[model samples]
Target: MTLEQLRALVSVVDHGGFRAASEALHKSQSAISIAIKNLEEELRVEIFEREGYRPLLTDHGKVLVQKARTVLSQARDLSDLAQHYAQGVEAELRIVVSEVFDIQEVLRALRIIRDQYPSTRLTLFVENFSAPLEILEDKEADIAMVAGGEMFDKIEMTRYEKLCPVSLIPVVSGCSREQKDASELTKEDLHGATQVVVTDRSRNRDERKYGILETSVPWRVNDFLTKKQIILSGLGWGRVPLHMIGDELASGDLVPLSSSDFGPVEIETYISRTTNHPFGPVAEAFWNLIIQRDYEKTNKITVKLQ
Candidate 1:
């Protein structure tokens, strides 16, 4: 019935469960459940199936959620516009970023905006590549930062200057004798080596192409950073972002295996917003700041590396 309730419903659907949605919304699980229940009662429809612990959306629930999204989007636009007009600045901007982009850079950008804009509040959502795109397409986020691959036809995307492709180099800690030196690493080096893999099951489509993951023992991790940690602890060897492990590599804590590139798993960085969607002035200002930050980073990298 209320916009807040509508948002809670959509968040639950977006996150694929109640607990995740609760975490995202910063509300109690019971509060989220109550909001959805109240909305269902007001609409007189069984929006979600109660049979499973993770409630599945009913056919009618899907339709209402779509309608709710539009309604809430409009309501949010109105609020943003009113705040912009009254205070001469924007109220808040919610952005979703993929895991590939350095999280510290994003935080730095926000801090710069706080110093410059002074009125804008920022909310950051971090997820794997696919989830960020979903949030951008659904208009849930004002803007999204992604490490690009083949361009998706779903939304209008602006490619920023390409950041270093997150090279997925095989790495192992000093404790792993088999992976001590980069030159000693070879295709045969992987044979029987316990491999650590970072998987976002929701978005991983390479499983079919990779053919059955061959490992006598393997560790599956959800977070990319965790995968790096496991590798550093000598539990197993796995590919990691080249930029992420620069410090470890410098300190000899971890070493790359094989001089051959991992076929360049280049992750291009991009900033995207929905086509033809309205943005408040604060949103525009924040967008400019993001662009400026990327430009500065590119220039800095070029200078240091070149």
Candidate 2:
């Protein structure tokens, strides 16, 4: 079948109806119907059966569609690679990362790429981890750095060494460091303290449930650095990554109100993309740099202020 026919088939399966698929593909509804009919005839099977008013895929059709998705995804990647290749630079690599990663470290890596492969281009998109995964699925990003260990049928992950585990330590400014003890500190101790959380809408439900809340007033901040500043200024006590505030903690600018471990939050790093598409030279080269040396080693700094 032609690539257009395969594309039409995949779109119908994805959008779940010929009319919806037509609208999405910007083709007339009749054209979509004709494509599906042509596909069914070639395959000699009823791809769709009427179920109530909506068309449902036959069992055989479901199997065909599954394969069709991979075919279409790979075809699109081939087209993208070709277009990028024609542009004549080494290649283009697109990546997405979370704010939790040190931005400076990411910039340094790009600088090295520029010095080594002067013709190559690197595009970086920064967002929460979930958004990066979405980009990978849509094929918008060549590679994405996201939270690791979960497997999806369409995405493949290559593990990078674990960066520092984030510990959600509680902090309060102006609270007598002398009285610092986790067990002695209770929710009542946070009664008047303002609690700030980094604006991560997709954070685990357990994080929200276990979070310190002020029955009186709760503050939500969008920027992690700003949130840390607010906490250090003693506006309120909230969870801050231990690594991010090492200098402040050491300098007494920020103090852990309680010594109790809030437990380590595992944030494994990964480079992920669709398994069906092979990485072009640029994507491969950039990923190689990420794996060549441990990110933590290059990015590690004394968080504790002297």
Candidate 3:
């Protein structure tokens, strides 16, 4: 019933007799006999037939020995896993990510972790802007995916490594800037229209602006998709990730701003550890995956505004 008893049984089967098992296991022969006796008494089965010079296993004894071998193998695996956990492997990891990442890249990382560390639990928190760092600093998250802007300036880069950059292409709804020629468009044209902005979802820190134009009136929203919906409604012009708005641009629901003079903004993304914080093995493995991801290059939003 116990692991010790199960191991004793397997050893006895492998070694041909109680005396041989005792020698193999470096235990007293009396102790081996007593363990086998206890196992038989507990299971109510005569395991060994003490018939001739060499002891032989009964039919039921053979079945139990096979079962005991499997159980003992699993027990050793459990012990190994326990040791692994004690050596900095975590039972769970928390990774907070910004809204603007390639879904495939995230899934690829998750799959690798699932395969490499099956027992480790992973929780993904999707937040926009500074919320990732807010979670990291407050000790809620072990790793954070943050935008590389003034947010990096607030935190020391010694604690972080560069991950990837997400392209934020400034685009307008098809209805806006109809009068301006694409090449001649300038700051004056953009200033004449309302600019949509997505607010940082951080509760702990003051929100910082990335690509907000100073001259235009700002329409602030909480989520990226909502901001996209607003811009699609011709509410305002705003920056969107090139990948997210590809279908919109293809279908003529949206187009890049008619401003050759306007900047092509790219939000530098980073995989940052909380300052002075130690990450578990699972989180570190995840961090490596982010670093190794060969991201497709970010292209500018040059979709002709029609």
lDDT of each: 0.73, 0.67, 0.76
- Greater-TM-score candidate between 1 and 3: 1
Highest-scoring model, lDDT: 3
Give per-residue lDDT, candidate 2, residue 302: 44
Pairs that clash in candidate 2: 246-303, 246-304, 247-303, 247-304, 247-305
* Tens digit of per-residue lDDT, candidate 1, span 1-306: 898899899999999898999999999999999999999999999999989988899999999999998898778667655766787665778899888777787777778778877767788898875677777766678888866544455445432333444555567787777654655665565667787876655453323212113642678787779988888888887777777888998888887665563332555667777644556766676677778877787788789998
TM-score of each: 0.70, 0.63, 0.62
Q: What stretches of model 2 exceed 4 Å from their correct place?
A: 50-54, 74-90, 114-123, 130-139, 150-184, 187-257, 261-266, 272-281, 291-306
lDDT of 2: 0.67
Clash count for candidate 3 is 0
User: What is the per-residue lDDT of model 2 for residues 1-306, given as tens digits with 9 covering 90 to 100?
Assistant: 777888888888778788999999999999998998998899899988976577888899899988888787778878876876676444667888766666665676777778877876678888664557767777877777764334333346432334443355667664544235543567665666567876655422113333656462668776568888887666666766566787887887776656343333446556666655566666666677766544546354443432
Candidate 3 C-alpha lDDT tens digits along 1-306: 799888788888888888889999899999999999999999999999998887789999999998997687566556545755687677777888888876667888889999998988878888887778877765567788887545656655227777557888777777655423533557776775788888865664545566687898998888778989988887887888777898998887787764556756778788888544556678888888877764323222223322
